[model samples]
Structure formats: structure tokens, C-alpha cells
Target chain A: MSVLRKIWTALRGSARELGDAVVDANSIRIFEQEIRDAQAAIDDSKRALTGVMADKMKIDRRLAELNDLIADDEASAVKALEQDNEALALEVAQRIAKREAERKEQFEIAERLASQIASLRQKIDAAEKIIADHQRELSIVRTTESVQKATVQIVDNIAAQDSTLSSARSSLERIKARQQRLDDRLAAGEVLARESGEQALDEKLKAAGIKGEAADANAILARLRARAES
Target chain B: MSLLQDMTLSLANTVFEGHRFDCLPISGEQEVLQVQVSGLEEMPIYVTVTDTQILCISYLFKKSELKEGSINELNALLLELSLPMPLSSFGMVGDRYVIYGALALTATAEHVMKELTTLASNAVDALQTLEPYLK
Candidate 1:
């Protein structure tokens, strides 16, 4: 059966049970098996491709030898005709024709082997892509299982501790409350800092004899003292 | 050690996007890293690493938390809004509705950090948007 059909069956089974751990586990197992099978098939194809390449190489060598033989025979036939030896030239021509036929046959075999190798490579690439896709989907399924299980523990912990993570509404309320508190704290801090900032500025001005009633009184006292000294 | 366990140790001292994470290892069949980002303590994102990918998930709400008649509407709305939500999507793991994001295993630490931050913030936004649907 197809991988998609298997996935569909698994999904339907899971939905029927609504969170059945067994079905989830089985689906994961099936995906793992599928990936393994694809990898094995790719390995086999690679081996077969090696064999096809070897055969093509053998055919190529034979074709090269036949071409050389055909060339030598044609040269001999031409030499015989130049010498006015008709029967010898005809015999040499027949030998060249035989070599040509053998080369043609070998060439056709090499072409078939080349095409077979190409198709095998394409099949390997497609199988590799399918394995990759299946691995990703399996990863997602496993991650979901881990996440749900982890959250189950968290839920149990929440129930045990009786904390605020029981529901979304309560958690949101707590989050809002925390935010509100932080905002209030910031606002209060700003007010206090502003008040103290003003006080510090007042003290600095008085000390500098710049802009305060205390500074005016000090100026009057200084003037009286200076006048007395003069 | 698994990749996530190594990350759990490294991320303890690491801060991303001005937010620090407190990585708590949840021991189970598959070790899950429950990373609680600073300032968003309530919405912790779970990190699980497989050979192929690193997945980050944050629980938005549970099935029981949805209003009696709002599950279908909420699911449809979530599907529509998921497209516009940057770098994250909504899904369900068992009874809990979650917002999640995924990254390749070969992703850099910076990439993982960015994914974690985005997933955490996305969960908060999704929860707030889904407030009307909750009980």
C-alpha cells in the first residue's frame, strides 16, 4: 500500500480512539519501517547501477576494438583494389562489414546500458526524496507525542501543586494581574522619583545660593557680617 | 548527550532578543526541554530535537478550556490566522492546542534562539486573541 494511504488509516484510527497512544506508536513504527525500506532499496539500486556501468564499460572496450579492426580491414581492402586484386579486396570488404555489424551491436548495447543507468539514478534520487519527506513527517509525529506527554506531566504537576496553570482563562487572568502590578509599580516608582528629584534640586539651589528663601536669608546674613567687618 | 540536552546546558547562560531562558529538562522517554523565557514566565515553550529537525511548541490552551460551542469556530479562525503569524503555526497535541515552530537540525544557535523567542511570543499573542473562545 501507499504511504499516504497508511498515514490516512493511522490518522483515522487515532481519531476513532481520540488520543490513543497505541495508534500513535504504531504509526511511528510504520514510518520508521518505510524509511528503512526506502534506504535499503536505494542501496540495492546503487549496486545495480554499478553493475550496469561495468557492463557498459565492457561494451565500450569491445566497440573500440571493433572500430580499430574495421579501420584496418578497410585499409587492406583499399590496398588490394589499388593492386588490381578484386577477389582479395572483396574478401577484405566482407571482413570490414562483419566488424562494422559487431560494432553497431555493441554500440546499441552501450546505449541501452547508459539509459538504464540514468533511470536507476533517477529512481534512487526519488527514493531518497521520499525518505527525507517521511523522516520529516515522522519527526513531527514524535515531537507531538513528546510534547503532549510532557504537558501531561505539567498538567499533573499543576494539579498537584494547585497552581494557576489550570486553565487558559485563569492563566490569562494571572498574566494580566502580573502586568497590572508591574505597571502600578512603575507608576509608583516614577512618582516617588519625581518627588525626591524635586527635593534634591531644592537642596542644591539653596546650597549654591541660587533660588530659594534659605539662600535669600543667607545672603542677608552675609551682607550684615561683611558690613560689621568693614 | 542528545542535541537538546547540550542546548539545555548552553542556553542556561545564553540570552536572545534581550530575553533570558531558564531551560528545565523534563525527563521522559524523549527528553524535552521546557524553556521558560524571562518576562513571559507563564507561557513556556517546549523544545524537542530529533535527528532531522528541532521543534518548539507552546501550549495555548487545552480542549477543556474552550467554550462549549467554540471549538469549530476557534479551529477555523486559527487556521486562517496561522498564515499571517510569522514563523509559527497552530496545532493540537492530544488535548492541548499549541502554537509551534520548527527549524532544521543544522540551524545555528542564533536561529534556534530566534525560533524559541518567536514561538513564545506567538503563543502569548494567540492566547490573547483566543480569549473570547476560552471558558
Candidate 2:
């Protein structure tokens, strides 16, 4: 039995993993499918539950009629006995006994239907909760996937933009040139002063590189400082 | 007084509080201060003292040197935070993006220190935030 249980557990775990993979790879599609599935389940459960409730209502109506008939039969039998009509009284007594049997049957039916209605309501509640949880998980998964995609795209864009950024450096150079043209005060001879402003940081980064691999910004920064202090 | 002049005075005053910095001889016409921020490692910042503004820049990694496709996330984050960051912004310096702060020349020692501190702290935070994305 234990070995059988172990196999069952393993199967369940594998099935869960397979489901997770499907959800991860096609989260939106899975989410929509999940919504559709949950709605269908809810509809089915509602139908079943509605049938149970309708049975309960029908039994309750019959029980009410039986109760009224029981009261009328007792009153009529009592009146016949008081009038000294034994035959009439006995006939009423027979009808009263038959109704008593019917009332018992109707009562039993009502009780059973009531119990069924309660059980169905509980099942529906549980199913609804499961559906809600599925929807919540789907939302969170979609959000996380979006963030990951956006991150990848942004990195690719910048890597691709490296050449265009050199254009930016030239634009900066132009801005500096224009500034030089405007002021015409600071000697252009101090070219290193302006260009080095940008390149100093560049050189420092290059110094921190490990075999052309991008070094951590923090590590490169530390190296630059160590060089400065030395 | 010139922008560099006030910066020199503030540096002498140790106004940047705990951060380390040194004067730089341009390799040009603009006098610059190099500030070293200590975090998980030492980070380099180039401070250019212009006639109008003081630009404090911390050099990040080179775009060319990073493994292909590693920078998309970092770029996305920078783009997202650029506008919301009131004190500093990311700019391309050569092939690298540097986090920098711009301050008015007439700004007081207290103000300069604040700007420098914010820019440095943010750069460190950014490095940590982007560490996972780095290849």
C-alpha cells in the first residue's frame, strides 16, 4: 500500500509540474483558458445546485399540503365521533391513517432534499474559491512575465544603441565647440581639459575591465579610486 | 568666483562628509574633481566645474564590453527612473552611462554635499539593482 501511495504521489507531482510548465510558457493563453474553464464549471455546478434546490422546494410544498390535510382529517373524524356516527368516524379514521403514512414519506423526501441542497451549496462554494485562486495566480504570472520581457528589451535596445551614442558624444563635442564659439575666452589649446572629462571615466572603466568582459560598475569604481589614491 | 573655486573650497572643508575625492588635471580647459564612492566596491565619479553648473558623474560599465543582450534591462530601468529622479540623471559618456548630478555654480557647500551624496548613493543602489542583469 505504501508503495502504491508513493507511485500515486509521484504521478501527481509530475502532473503538477507539467501544468506549471504549460502555464509558464503560455500564461495568457492558459489564463484565458482557465477563465473559460472556471466559468463552465460554475455554470455546471449552478445547474446541479439549482436542481437540488428545486427538489427541496417541491418536497416542501407537498409537505405543507400534507400537513393541512392531516389537520382536516383529524377534525372531521372528531366531529363524526361526537355525532355518534361510528361508521362515518371509522371511515374518516381510515383516511387519516393513509395521510399519516403519506406525510411520513413526504417528510423523509423533504429531509433528504434539504441535505442534498446543503451538500451541493458547499461544493459550489469550494469550486468558486478554486476558480478565484486560479484567476489570481494567472494575473500575478502575467505581470511577472511582462516585467521580464521589458527588461530584456531595454537591455537589447541600449546594446544596439552604442554606435548611436557615439553620435551623442559628437553632439556633445559640437555643443562644446559652439560654447567655445560663443565665449571664445577659454583657450582651445586646453582640448584635453574638455575631452578628458569624458575620457577619464572611460579610461578608468577600461582599466577595471577583466579581459574585455564588462566589470561590475562598483568594482570598476573601486579600482579608479585605488588608482587615484596611489 | 569661478565654479571650480567654490568646489576647491568645499573639498578643503571636507563638505562631502564621508566620500573621497581629488582634484584632476584635465588630460583640457575645464577643471574637474574626481570623487571615489565606496560601496560593494570603489566607484569613480568625474565632477566637472563649469562656469554655470557643477556636473558630478559616476562612470558605469561600457556598453561595448558587456555581454550582448545584457544591457536591455538596465536600459529599461534607467529609462523608467530617469524622469522621476529629480536630483540626478543618466547620460552616455563615450560608451558608458554615468549617473550624474548637476548643481548651480552659486550653490552653497551644504547643497553641493547633498547633491553629491544623493548621486553617489543612487549609483550604488543602481549597481545592486542591476547586478542580476549583468553578464
DockQ of each: 0.53, 0.02
Candidate maximizing DockQ: 1
lDDT, candidate 2, residue A64? 88
lDDT of 2 by residue, A62-156 (tens): 88898898899899989999999999999989998898898899888888888877887777787788667766565444332332332233334
Off by over 4 Å in 1: A1-19, A22-38, A83-91, A115-144, A157-164, A200-230
Instruction: Indicate the residue-level lDDT of A15 in model 1.
Output: 42
State the TM-score for model 1.
Answer: 0.79
Q: In the order shown, what is each candidate's alpha-carbon RMSD?
A: 5.3, 24.6
* TM-score for chain A as predicted in candidate 1: 0.66
Off by over 4 Å in 2: A1-23, A26-38, A155-230, B1-135
- Candidate 2, residue B88: the lDDT equals 81
Clashing pairs in 1: none
lDDT of 1: 0.80
